[model samples]
Target: MRKQRDIIKQLTDRELNVQLIISQFSLVFLSIILSYILFDSFVDWLNYFKLSYYDIVYYGAASGLLIVIIDLVFMYIFPKKYYDDGGINQRIFRDRSVGGIFLLALLVAIAEELLFRGVIQTTFGYLVASIVFALIHFRYLKKPVLFVSILFVSFYIGYIFVLTENLLVTIMAHFIIDFTLGLVIRFQKRGANNE
Candidate 1:
């Protein structure tokens, strides 16, 4: 573990960005292939992407705004607590462009939602899927508050999937939260650097 952390710590910002993009795309491709092989219908597994435009707009906006608000409240209440470690800031947000951040967040949101909500939740049900999602985000385990936040977000995403039966809704919501957060972090890092 120490060696792995050392290697990660040594990576330059561009190298880390490349690594993140490749890994996220790999996850997306592998999840689709595995879902197809296991379920015999990747489209079905994806909830057929059946949402209407209105559904997409509504849920996307609503969920996105809700999550941003929640995040803001959390940050306000525990300003130093959340980002005190600075590991993510140094690795992911350092010197990242807005476009780069958006692309990274979009890829991550799509890949994670497809695997966790579209495939796992549909297969294993909400409770198990939520737990699995939380567990995979093991970095947050040391921070119980963040861990619980992830669990809640996972369950919320799962619930949206259940309600809409459309992977697009969850995907959009995930993208919004990720993209918004990414932008916030990137700008904050920029501001800090300027200071």
Candidate 2:
């Protein structure tokens, strides 16, 4: 664990790193299925807990919007620099077409919404679950301020997920936040390397 963290730190930039490609695919499938396996109980818990529909909708929409706004700020502040070969514009738009961006995005949208928002979070409650979410990302990020910022955003997203009991809102929020940020971050790296 220490060694891996060290390697990750030395890296100039972060890209999607899969632990095991086949295993990750398998896990995504299995996790989604597992999430649905408990759907009935989850719904029952939601009602039993007496969560208001309005609360759910309001938090879900608000958090989603908040994350998007933050992401856009980051993008503008740190615009991505990408492949000069395809030209930065093409790298941002056209290059993605050649890859599995759409499919991967869809898969991530489904799996993450189901597993993170739908299942574990529902099972654990927001405050506790958000802590876990923050912890999961902790090792990759160590700066106190940055880590706290990310955690706050993650917790906010978790809060909305619990409030709404609607995966669509969380997934859309996560998708927009991640895609815009990830694209810019990636482009920034490529952009920087170009110079």
**lDDT (CA) for every model shown?**
0.77, 0.55
Candidate 1 minimal-lDDT segment of 10 residues: 82-91
Cα RMSD to the true fold for all candidates:
2.0, 7.5
Cα lDDT tens digits, model 2, 35-150, are 56766653553342334555434554456567767646654565333112223223333334323444544555555555566667876677776776667655435445446656
Give the TM-scores of the predictions, in the order they appear.
Answer: 0.90, 0.60
Model 1: runs farther than 4 Å from truth? 3-5
lDDT per residue, candidate 1, 152-171, as tens digits? Answer: 88888888877887878888
